[model samples]
Target chain A: MDRLKSRHLQIAMFLLPALLFYAVLLVYPVLRTFFLSLHEWNGFAGSKVEYVAFDNFKLVFEDEIFWKSLKNVMVVMLLSIAIQIPAGLFLALLLNGKWKGIRFFKAAFFMPVIMSATSISLLWKFILYPGDGLVDGLLMKMGLEDSIRAWLADPSINLYTVILICCWQGLGVVMIIFLSGLVSIPDAIKEAALIDGANRRQRLWFVTLPLIREAVAINVILLVIGTLKIFDNIYVLTDGGPNHATDVLGTFLYKEAFRNNRFGMASAIAVVMFLLGFVLTLVANRAMRRESLDG
Target chain B: MTNAKVLRSSFMLVILAILITLTACGGNKGNNSSSSASSPAASSASSEAASEAPKEKVTLRIASAYTPDHTFGPAIAQIIDEFTKQHPEVTVEKEFLPVAELDKKLTADRAANNLPEIFIIFPGAGTADYVKEKKIIDLSEYLNADPDWKDGFISGALDNLKFEGFPGIYAAPIGAYSTGFYYNKELFQQAGVEPPKTWDDLLAVIGKLNAAKITPMAIGASESWRSEHLFTALFYKWNGAEKAKGILSRALPYSSPEVIEPLNKMVQLVEAGAFSKNYIANNYAAEIADFNNGKAAMRYSGSWTVGESTGPNSPAGFGDKVGFFPFPYFADKEEHKDSWMGGVSDSFAVSSRAEGHQKDMAIELVKTLTSTASSKLITEMAHDLTAVKADVDPAKSGKLIAEVSKAMSTGKEFSGDISAFEPYKPANTKLYDLTQAVLLKGITPEKAAKQLDDEVAKSK
Candidate 1:
């Protein structure tokens, strides 16, 4: 009994630091945001904080900009999954072979993933700079001058431009994730598929993709969470501007809290974002799990 | 002993070690915090003693948005160096943050009652907020105590720091600037047009520039503040300074003809394509680049551009060919022609909590920072305009600087950025957004004006 008590005490002691850190860093902030969202605070230290329960959330829901930001985030999420996943999977398959210089190809493809988002956004901004930008110049040289549009300026198309850059930056990570999953699969499985008269496409569909369910699940969750929190790239590229044509929830929350000094309103946005991320992640994981089980 | 007993004893020893470590850390933290808490008071007391005994030390911390790479950085360093040389027993600790970050940090510090001894403050609305909260010390009494120092500041420069409803001057002017057009004479001549002197003249000039295939202006409407700057220029031109201030006091609604008319004229310029191609897509850097590279005829900006344009960094500087003109006035509003937009760029403020020797040191630092010699050095070194009167040598002050100095000096009255004059931060942000929308045709001028009025009313 004495030894059991000692063991339990030892376990508690071992867990205390990590638990304390989690509470202080993560739990405390989340709870504090929720508390703040229920009040009106201008984010100044000496300013009056009034208890205005649900008012901030009500305002957020009523805000057209908030709805616009949500729609933009959803577009990004949908496009990221549609574009990045297939492109990543294709690249993974292409580089999975033991061809010479495959490593170089893989590294080149993965380069953008390692670079900072701010740098990527800046680089792309330069490349897509209007009138004399690389894209316009290339189009003009190709006799496609009519195709050149204000890539980061036009409200109608700037969000899509941002989505394209995001897809480019995100492709490398998804490809690497799929590559790891592919490498871990038993070689015998592919050989068996081959012996069973499976074509390249058939083998990919029947043998390889089924085996990488976990990676797909991870990629989906990561892309969803990433798109929802996308700020730095959009912020750097356009600052959610040309009239906030690219504002995501992250940027909107930042503007509310820091720019407008409405911490309560920003906290309400954050809470909504958190709940949305949590629900979407759960739904994605569950759907992925169900498919895996069916397979 | 048994194995279980030995294990238990070892576990107990590990727990004892951890407890001892935690307690030591806690004790050290307590001592550090307590010492830090008392250090300022102790230093002030020591400085008071040092006046009598002559060997004690005083440390003063100043926070500012001026980084070492900024033009003002070297000027600030010189002032600090001069001050420290005069007072060997004093140390001035500098905390430099970017402007946006500094606003946040200052707000946080004010809440905690832990502001640095001195800090840079935005001249109008930002000063008003700090003054309203009584977080910053009023400088009126100190300025008045020394007649020479009070008179040293340029006429009307200090008034820019004075806010309505605030009883005292909350800040001392450090830098003064005004906004207007910075145009390339070569481009104007290429288009066979002179700098516009009135709204109708501006339209005629724009037509000629467009005919000559020159962008009449470069506006980075993607950055909403650019749109806000244009709005201010138009508003001040048509309505005059008094009516502009009336909007701030809510005596005039934003939706009133005085405000909406300017918004309409701005939209008309957008429709006329006065700005660069895809101007709404361009950022501030792109706008400046267009003007600098001679791709555009004019760039609407502030006096701060003089340093960069004349500096070695400029690839194709116009040198003496650069000319500045205030935004064209309304042809009919000749009475309000002298009303220009722009005033104090930034100011230095002392903390209200600062007392005794610390307060004395802070005030002395401000005086040193804005002294005639220091202001002249800043003017020559940085091509900056200071709030204090400085005799700028035209040979050292480039053509653009000299011209801007003349324009600012001759201006009868200055109203600051209209958006910046709003004490409520959210309304200020909304005004910028509405201006951007209006410029982009996302909303009509009438709608934008109504929205601005609604936002201000709601914020109030």
Candidate 2:
């Protein structure tokens, strides 16, 4: 019992710094934000705060712009999960094969992921500009004038344009993770699947995908979190405008908090955002856990 | 522990320590700069007094939200140099922030209770809120004693400097500007259309231009503020002065027939292809470029465009071609035809927390920068249309400024933008979005009007 207590004390000492950090950085701010959300005050407009008791949250729920932003966030999440996952996995599979210049392709594919979001957004904005832009110029040259439209300006395509840019920038991490997972799968398992008369697709499905389940889970969660918190891309590209059609929760929160000076409303939006992320993450984790157990 | 394990643990500890130290040092530097910037006037005054005996040097820090090339920068530097030269015992350290970042930084400073002794106050009903909060010092005491300072300001400039139920001045006007339509004279000539003298004439001109396959106007609606400017312009025209003021002050509903009339008109114009294709995506600079490049016949903008059009780096023919007009009013309403949407005062307020000599110095700085001579110099250099009555050479000042001045003289009343003059509870963002939606085909004028009404009702 004495030995056990000593060991426990040592473990607590080791964990103390992390606990202190979490308390100061995360827990404190969240609690303070909860307190602030109950008051109606512009963050800097003196101390004439009126305690309205959940009015701010009620206002957020009733705001049409808030609902529009949530829809945008959902669209972005679906695009990231549906498009980015398959694209990244395919790239990882291609890179895993032995081929000339494969290493160079791997490095090139990862380059955009390491670049700053602002820089990438700016580059893509220029590329997608309507007139005198690279894409438009190329289309004009090919006598495809009908095909050219102001890609970023069209309400029908603006959100998708932003999603495509985000997917391109984030594909690197997903690719690298899957590549590492693929390498870790024993070559003998693939060989055995092939000998058992499994086709290429069958081998990949039966042997490779099962082995990379943990990597797939990590990639999905990372993509979800990243997409949920997306700000810089949308901010630099559209600024949630052209009629508030491109607004997402992050942009909405920024406008509420900074521009309108409605700190309470911004916090409420943030709290809702957090709850959505938390619930979705739990559901994903459970599904992945069940999948692993079945295998 | 094994040797490898021990070595790895030590490496990890060192890395962690370095990270902590870096973060702490970064945080400390940020805090130091902010504190120094905030309390500059106090520190500068104390150091000046300390150096009166000729024993030590004095240094001052000035936080400015103007870039070095901006007109305010040179004006500020000149004031600081003059003040320091008179004292002979002071030095100023200046820190500048970009214009776009100014409001955010000021908001943060205000929240922290660490505002600079002197700062720019955005002129609007919002300034009233700051006055109510006691963030700004009442300047009536100072202005009353100085006749020269009081008289030098343009007429009606000090009206916005007042707080509720009090006649005392709390801010000073640096300059004045008005928004209006800028049309290409060459385009009008080429299209064989006369310059518009009324709202109907303007619509007729737009119709002619659209028939010729040229967009009548180019506007940047992506930025909500830019879109709001057009709404304000139309509101002033459609609702007339008294009703417009009532609407802005929240005494009238946003969904009133008067408010919806202009939106319906704007939507009709959009359906007729008055604005450039994809106007909602273009930025302010890009829209300006579009008009300058002859792709659009007109742009609605402020007097700031004068400098850009006539500057040395401007595209060829812009200086010779660009012309200005007050956005047309209804010709049928003869009594309101001359009333122009304009205002005096780009204002600044002193922080109330500043006291004694620091406060005195800030007031001195404001007076010096806003003096007639300084104002003239800034106006001429920036190609701005100054509100102050002064003899300026038309040939030297350029045609745009002359045209604006001519209109200003003939104008009967100067009505300010609704959002700028009064506080409506739902905020300007909703109105701005509604206008853009009309322009972008996202909503019909009737639907937009109803939505505005809903927002106004809900907000109350």
Candidate 3:
């Protein structure tokens, strides 16, 4: 027993540095943020800090801009899942086989995942620039000027434009996830399915897809969390403007905290964002687990 | 294993833990100080404990929002270098961040109580918070120490830096900027129009420009400050500055017709197609490019454009063809005819966190930064106005800069930026959003005004 205690103490000594770093950097800030959410503070040294429990959350709830940002993020999350998954799967399947220049094609598909979001947003902004930008210029050249609209200016379609750009950026990672899943499938399983008289569609539905359910679960959960916290692209592209038609929770919280100096309100929004991502992820994990058990 | 071996290993582990804890503590102390030797306050205390050492080398850190290529950036750098040359014992560490990035960084630093020893205090609302919190020390005593430096500043230039109810001088002005319409003279002539002097004249010019197939104005609503500047010009032109202060004090509601009228005019401009096609999507760079490229007839911007429009940096090669005019006023409201939205918008302040010798060094840095010699460099090299009176020869400066300089001096009254709408910044943000929404026709002027009023009320 004494030897075991000494070994345990030695192990803890090894883990102490990491634990200290984690507690100071991560745990402390999170708890501090939670504490800040319950007070009214302008985030200034020696400034008045008033404790008004849940008032910040109440204010956030009553804010129309907050609701609008929430709705915009929801749209991005739903559309990212709808578009990125099937498209990523299709691309992954097409590129999965051993073919000529398959590596090059795979690299091309995954390039944007490694590129900076700010640069990508800037490139897209230049392309979608109104009147003289590439898209409008191309439309004019093709005599399709009638269909051209303010891509990043119009409140009606600005959010959708940003969402599409986000989808473009996020598609690479999803494709890579699905590609890895496809590669891990055994040759024997596919051969067995084929021998059992399974057609291409039948094999995909019965054998291939069932095997990649784990990747899909991961992709879904990641999309949910990633889309919910989306900021840089929207910030660089529209900055939650054209009258804030494109604000997400991240940008809204950031503006509240940094721009407005309302740390309390921003902290509350952050807490809500965390709780939301947590609940949705748990639900996705449970659903995936249930499906796997049923299969 | 023997017990002696286990005991020796345990002793080694204990020493390791001690080392880790010591390193962590040391790291924290290092981060809080400009140098590894000591924190600024701690050093100040120690130095006070001893007699002043004249030969001691000191490091002063300064944070500012000027890019190297910015109009003021080169001039500011040259001046700081000159100061360091004069006093070899002083070492200046300069941090340059873009304006938006600097604002956020300063906010975070303020919260952590880790602001730099010396930093630029943005004018008006930007200085108010620092003053209220006493994050920045009062500069009156420092200014009084040298009458020549105090007297060098242009009259009323320091007025805006002094916040109401806070008595002492908290900042010294460095740069003065004014907001107005910058027109392409060639385009206006091509369109058979003159520089607008009144509201009716502006409308007629817009009509003629539209008929000439020229975009009348280039507005970038994506940057809300562009629209906010326009709104400020309209409000101050119609109602003047006194009433603006009244509105801020809640003596007048934003929904009042005097305030809503500016929104109505903004909506009218939108309805009349006075701005470039899809102007809402354009950024400040793109908007200015439109005007400079002669694609648009006019733009509403600050005097900073004068430097860029004339110097080698001028992208469009328009040269002297760029002209300036104040925002047109209502023909009947002649009281505010001479008024312009203008003031010293950037200044220098020493952080209160710097103590003893460091505090004195920071004050000396501020004085050096705002001295007459520095102002001349800024005016000549940057072609921008300084708070200090500098003799700018017309031969060396462009016609545009000369005109702007004349307007800065001759204007009867000046008002603050759109940031002055409320002490609560979120309400000011809401005002910016509302102005953009009105420009985009997303919301009516009346509704936008009512919404702005409601936002301000909520902040209170």
Candidate 4:
């Protein structure tokens, strides 16, 4: 009993330092944000935190811009799940083979993943500048001048353009993850499928895909989290404007906290975002688990 | 063992560990402060505290958005460096952030109560909010005691730096900017249009430019300030000084025709293809590029761009092609024809948190930063009007500054930026966002007015 108690103390000693940092950094902030959300404070300390219970949440509920931002976030999430996952998987499959120049191709594909989102977004902004930008310039060169439109200016389609850019930037990370998962699957499984008279397509469909189901799930989760947390690129590209048409939850909260000086409303939005990410990830994990069990 | 026994033991151990860490750190703090072998800052502080020290040394941590490349930063730095040279005991540390990121950074700093003693202050809602929270120390007392300092400022220059609904100088201003239209003379000449003599004449010029297939005006609505500058120009032009002030003070409704009429004119400009195809995508830089590259005929920006347009920064002959025009009014009916929107571009202030030596050091920094020599450096190097008098030479400061100086001197009315409207920043943000929505959402002038009115009502 003395030895067991000593070991338990040793365990506590090992864990305490890390736990202290975690509690101070993460847990403290989460609790503080919840506390701040309940009061009307303009981000200044000790300066009149008017205790307007649930007023911030109520304000967000009535705000048209907030609803619009929520809708935009939903659209981005849907697009990432449906488009990014498949595109990444397809690229991963194509690049998994030991081709003569596969290394060069992989390097090219993963380059954007290493580049900063802000720099990439700014680069793309100039490339898509309406009259003289590369996109419009190429169209004019090909005598498709009629096809030229203000890609980033049209509010109806600007969100989709930014989403496409995001997918382009993020696809490499998903591809690299899927590639690792593909490589991890035993070669014997593919050989066995071939020996059983399965065609190449059939072998891929039956063996390669099922073996990397975990990769698909992980990629989807990452894509979802990234989509929800999307701010830097969209902010650089459009800043939730030509009038809040491209607004997402992150930028919306940013505007509230910094621009409007409404820290309470921003915290409320942040809490809502956390809840969203929690619920969605939980649902996704459950669905993936149940599906894997069935398969 | 039972789970309860294990949990209790672990909790006890955790508390024990925390106590040890705290006691250890607390002991280190005392040791670190008392010894001369720690951080440079601590050593300086120790030296300052010494009673027999002949001179004291201190450092001021400044947070500024004035990057070295920006027009103001180098001149300001030169001024400060000169001060440091004269007063060898003082040290300055500056952190430069771009203007876009500065506000959010400063907001975080404010919340943490860690704002530097002397930092750049933008005289708008940010300054007002800081003043309201009592975070900024009133400089009036200091200024009053020093008549040379108080009298050195340009006539009425410090007026807008005061807090709304009070009589206190909240900021010490550095440079002033004037807002007006900058037209490409070559394009205007190509389109056979002179500077518009009336509101109708301006519309005719837009039509002519559209017909010529040259983008008539460049606007960067993505940055909402461009739209507000448009609003300021048109509103003040259409309805002279009194009505404009009335609208700003909320004595007259924002939905009043005097305001809505100018908004309608903006919509007309948009419908006439007065702006480039992707004007909404272009930010200030892109807008400037389009105008400089001769793709756009006209651009609205502050007079500070005089340096960039004329200097080696831009292509040669760019300066000669550019000319300024105050926003046009109804020639036959308008009063206050010389009125225009202009204000102090940047200001500085001392923090309320400053204590003892820090307070004196902060005041001294502000005085040195805005002294006549610094003001002269600002005018000659930055090509913007100084808040204090500076002997600007025509050969050095160039023709654009000379022209702007003449225009400013003749102008009878000058108002602050759109930020001066609505004390609460969120209301100002709403106004900017609604202006964007109106232009992009296909909302009519009346509908836009209604939305703006609703926002103002909610703001109350």
Candidate 5:
């Protein structure tokens, strides 16, 4: 009993500082947001905060724009997981080599990932701008005038424009993760697959992919969360304009809290977003697990 | 190591990480210049004051969105310098936040219970709210005590900033500005067109410009604010003050003729190719460049553009080519025929947080900055309208800002933006969105107007 007590005491001492910070920073703010969501608050310190129960949540439900934002988030999330993840993995596989320029290509592809979303959005805005943009100008010069697009200004393509920029900026992280996982795979296992007459495609689809289940799962989960919470790209590029057609949950929450001065509504949106992220992560993990097992 | 040892080690590392994070966060908070009054100047000034005579020293932090290059920036600096020189007992620390970041910084500091002792307040909803919360000081007592100061203020200037049914004034008026069509005079001359005398004249000018192959007008709706401001010029011309009041009072729906009429005219402009080609994708940078280089005949812009167009900010000879004109009113209506959209804009408000001697010092700072002398300086340098009546010669103000400033004075009455009015505050953002939808997305004006009315109803 005394030895057991000593072991427990040792554990508590090591954990106390971390627990304190976790509670203060992350846990406390989340709980505070939940509490604030239950009231009607203007977000001003001295302003009267009224207890409105679930009225804020009711307001959120009635917000058509908020729902549109969630739908936009879903579109971006699907693109991120379905398209971006595979694209990243494809790049990782292609670039996983010992060559003079392989490292250079890898570094170049990852360059945007290190830059801020605001700068990336502005750069793309200039490049994608119709009539005057580099892309459109080049197309016009090449007599591909029909290919010209208003890019971020058009309602139909603006959200996708933002999503693609996000993918371009974020591709490096997924690629780097997959590259580390690929490089870590043992030579023996790959040799064994080759000895069994497995070709490059078969080895990739069978042995190499199945081996990196953990990496794919992690990357997918990360992309889903990031896509759902994306704000900076939308803010700098479109600002949820062209008739709120490009609004995402993050921008919606920000508009409510900062611009509209409705903190309660913003908090409710935050909580709903949190739940969506949690459930989606769980679902993604399950799918990845099942797929890995099947492989 | 065994599994338990590894687990224990990782947890210990987590503890160490958390400690470092906590310390870092605390360290960061200590460095929060957001709420700090810059000290060195105040310290040195106070020491100098201490040498002269032992007086009860009161240090006040003054904050503003004005950069030193802004219209009133030099006047503001002069006020602080002169005040400190006169009263050695007072040390005023200045915090200069650019206009874009002022609201965010103010709110953050307000939440922290550490707002600067005096600050420039944006004119609109939040100003009223701040007054109600006692964050802003009531300035009527000071104004009333000094009839010179009271009479010196432009009529309706302070009253324009007052909260409804609230006693006294909460802000001191600094200046006024307007938004209108800033055209290239040389382009108009080359095209053999003068400034439009009426709405039809304006359209004819646009037609002539187009016939001459000069891009008739430049609008960068990609930026959105340009569109909203253009909507401001159109709406205020049609709605005027009384109709605007009626719409806000709910006596008239926004869908009424007053709104849809102007909305339709804007649509007409777009349909006529009066705006730049690919205007939907062209932003401020492109619009300004095209207009400055004479690729376009005109661009709808505001008073601030006058200073930039004529001052060092403009391209070489851009000022020489640029000219401003008020948006034309209805062809038939005699009433409000010369009415233009603009009114008493930016103001300085003392914080209620300051008490006793601190409050007195703050009030003195406001008086010095807004005095007639300071107002004239603001007019001549910044090319803005002074809220205090001052004789500003066109030659002194430069041709462009001077012309607009003259228009601001001669206009029948100053028509303010809908959002700046108290009742329209709740629906301001929705109004901007509605304007964007109507103009950019090609939604029907009637539908957009009704949507705005519905937004107001819902908010109520």
Candidate 6:
């Protein structure tokens, strides 16, 4: 019993520092945020704060702009999931093959992921400038002047432009992850499929894809979370402008808490965002688990 | 094995205790001076003489919402340098931020009670709120002791600096700005039209410019605030001061016909091809570029644009051609053409939480920066209109600045923008959105007014 107590004490001592840091930084703020969400405070003015439990959440639910922001987030998430996965998989397959200058190709594909998001967003903003921007200039040179339009200004297209930028920046990470997973697949499996007269597409679909399901799942989950919390790109790009056309939960929370000084409302929005993210990830995990079980 | 485990556990516990003690000691060291100096009465008394202490060095942190190289930042820096040179015991450290990030930083700072000794404040109704909350130190005592300092500012500029229902000054004005229509002189000449003196004439010029294949007005509606300014300018002329004041003060519903009329007129102008194609997508900076590059004939902006338009790196062929016109009013009998949209000042207030010599140094710096000599230097450097009446060279004043000054001086009542007077956050953002929606065609003027009513109701 004395030995066991000493062992437990050693483990506790080892864990103490990390636990203390977490309590001070993360756990405390989260509890404070939960408390803040229940009261109305301008965040600055020492105004009388009334506790209206759950009212802020009700207001958020009823706000049309909040719903629009959620919809915009969903559209961005779907686009990233739909386009990034298959494109990343294809690139991963190509990079995994024995080819000349494969190292150069890998570096080139991974370049965007290494660039800062602010720089990338600003670069895209410059490229999409209406008349003299690179995209417009190139289109005009190609006798496509009629096609030139303000890419970031148009409400119909601004969200899509941001999504395209996001996918472009994120493609490198997804590709690298899939490439590692493909490399880990037993060469014997591919060879066996090939020996059975499987073509390129057949071998990829039957052997490589099934084997890399774990990587695919990881990639999807990461992309989903990343897309949901996307702030910098949207903030730098459109600022949720042209009539709040590009607002997302992150930007909305930022505006409310910082710009509007409604800390309670902002915290409520944050709580909702956290809940949504947690619930969606759980649902996705459950679905994936069921798929694995069935397979 | 048990003995070894016991020894390891004892050693680990010792290390943990050491770490906790070190952290505690470090925290105590950090707080020792601050907590002692933080009592309001103590700081208030010490603020005056803290600079005289030769042995104690006090560093004052100033937060500014201007880029370091911008006119405002450098002006403050120059003043701080002069102050520190005289009083070597006091040092000022500045943290420069872009305008977009200022409110966010300020909000976080306020919550943490870590606001800078001196920070920028908007002299709107929100100043009243800050005063009520006692977040900012009252400047009445400081200003009253130095009566000559009051003479340095432009007349009536201090009106906005007064807190609601309070008899004393709560903040100090750093500079002033006014909004008007800036037209390209060359473009106006090329189009064979004079500057429009009335709303009808302006519309006629728009029609002519459209026929000539020129985008009459270049605007950035995407930023929302810039677009909102145009609506405010129109509202000022359309509804007159009394009605506008009533609507802005929430004494009248935004959906009242008085408020909706001007919005509808703005919509009509939109339908009549008054603005550039794809104007809804343009940002304020981009729109300025369009006007400067001769792609668009005119832009509605504040005097701040003068610097960018006439600066050394100004776009090709923009020099000597920019001209100003007070935003025109419709010739209808009811409209007040003499009324203009103008504000007294943009200011900085010392935070109440600042202690020791920091508060004193901050107030001194603000006073020095706003002195006539410094204001002249900054105005000339920034190519901005000077709020204080000074002997600026007519040639140096730039025709646009001269014209705006003339307009403001001659105008009947220089009423503030309703949006400018609103409190920070929800009210201000709602106004910004309403203006943007009008410009973006997301809502008609009637609907825009309705949206304002909805926002007001929700806010209340």
TM-score for all models, in order of appearance: 0.88, 0.87, 0.91, 0.89, 0.86, 0.91
Best by DockQ: 4
- Misplaced by over 4 Å in model 6 are A1-11, A45-49, B1-41, B48-56, B65-80, B315-317, B333-335
Per-residue accuracy of model 2 over A198-228 as CA lDDT, tens digit each: 9989988878999999999999888888888
Q: Which scores better on TM-score, 2 or 3?
A: 3
Model 4 Cα shift for residue B30 (angstroms): 19
Fnat: each model in turn:
0.43, 0.25, 0.57, 0.55, 0.30, 0.48
What DockQ does each prediction reach against the true complex? 0.41, 0.23, 0.45, 0.48, 0.27, 0.46
Query: TM-score of model 6, chain A?
Result: 0.93
Show pairs that collide, candidate 2: none
Task: Give model 6's TM-score versus the native structure.
Answer: 0.91
Task: By TM-score, rank the candidates, best first.
Answer: 6, 3, 4, 1, 2, 5
lDDT of 4 by residue, B71-105 (tens): 77778788778878987877888877887677677
Return whichever of 3 and 6 wins on lDDT: 3
Q: All predictions: root-mean-square deviation over Cα? A: 4.5, 5.8, 4.2, 4.8, 5.8, 3.7
Please report, as a residue range, the 10-residue window in candidate 5 chain B with the lowest summed lDDT. B32-41
Alpha-carbon lDDT, every model: 0.82, 0.75, 0.83, 0.79, 0.78, 0.77
In candidate 5, what are the lDDT values of residues B1-460, reduced to their tens digit?
5557656766776667666776877677566533233343453465455555546689989778677867567767876788899999899888887764686688777765578888888566657777766677678878998887777778878877777768878888886777778899889998999988677888899999988888999777776567677776776666666566665567877778887887888888887779765677777767777777778998777687777667655687788888888887767764667667777777888875565566667788888888887777777777766678776767877877767866766687766666554254336777767777767755899988877776676564
- Model 6: per-residue Cα lDDT over B1-460, one tens digit each: 4766766766667667656866886587567435634667777677556666754776777777656545455555666678889878777777778765776677787766577878878776755766776678778788878877777778888777886576778777766778888888888887888888888888899988888888898887777767667777787788776676575467778777766777777787788898877787677677878888998898888777777687654775575788888888788833487777777656778877766666676787777766787777667666776445455665654666666777767677666666764543475787788777876777777767776676667775
lDDT of 4 by residue, A1-295 (tens): 7678778778887898898777666876799799978888777655577888998898888888889999999999999778888899999999998889999989899999899999999999989977678998999999998887768777878899999999998889999999999999998887888889999889888898888889888988888888988899998888888778899999999999988878999999998899889998998888888888888
For every candidate, what is the interface RMSD in angstroms?
7.0, 9.1, 5.9, 4.6, 6.9, 6.2
TM-score of 1: 0.88
What's the ranking of the predictions by lDDT, best on top? Answer: 3, 1, 4, 5, 6, 2
- Model 5 TM-score (2 dp): 0.86
lDDT string for model 3 (B1-460, tens) is 4566665676577667656765786577556543422454575576465336664677898999767868888888888888899888889998889876787788888887778888887666656878876778778866888998999999888776788898888888887888888899899889999999899899999999999999999877777778888888888888887777776678788789988898888888887889866777787778867877878888888888888777667765586798888888889998988778888877888887776666777888998888887888788888777788876666666678888766666678887785675666887778888888887889888888888777787775
